[model samples]
Target: MSNMVKIAMTSDLSPGTGTTIEMEDQSIALFNVEGNFYAIADTCTHRGGSLGEGRLNGDIVTCPKHGAHFNVKTGEVTFPPARFGVKTFPVTIEGDDVLITLD
Candidate 1:
């Protein structure tokens, strides 16, 4: 089973940007890509870089520490210094709330 946790409101995040969300068990990178939202594990697979602090271009986020690139929509490594992909979470917008599912 999965639990949906409300992280922010739709109005809180702007398009073409990202933010870090700290939960009890994990850190998440939440991105707003042209109005659609995506959530991924905040840590870069290469050197524990913060993906939330990375640069967002289109749907790809570049790791701030080492330039590893990840697809925000799927959490797949697009370009690498990091061979492993990060984990992805499902995001939903209900009314004005932005929620991510944790399993």
Candidate 2:
């Protein structure tokens, strides 16, 4: 089972940008890609780096700590230094709110 949590508003994040959201003692990384929203684990699998502070290029986010790349839309490792993929959450937009499904 999963619960949809409202992480942010559409206006909170612009296209090609990302932010970190804290809820239920978990850190979630939210990204806005061309008006589409995606959610993933904020911590990089390789290191304890903040994925929210990473550079967003298209749908991929590059970790600032060691240059590891992760696909925000799928939470898959795209580049080196990170061998494992992070957890991905389904995103839903309702009116002005951005919600993500969390298990």
For candidate 2, report its TM-score. Answer: 0.97
Put down candidate 1 lDDT per residue, 49-78, tens digits, no spaces. Answer: 999999999999999999999999999999
**Model 2 CA deviation exceeding 4 Å by range:** none
Give per-residue CA lDDT, model 2, range 1-103, as digits (tens): 8888899999999999999989888999999999999999999999889999999999999999999999998899999899999999899999999998889
- The TM-scores, one per candidate, come to 0.97, 0.97
Looking at model 1, the pairs that clash are: none
Lowest summed lDDT across 10 adjacent residues in model 1 is found at: 17-26
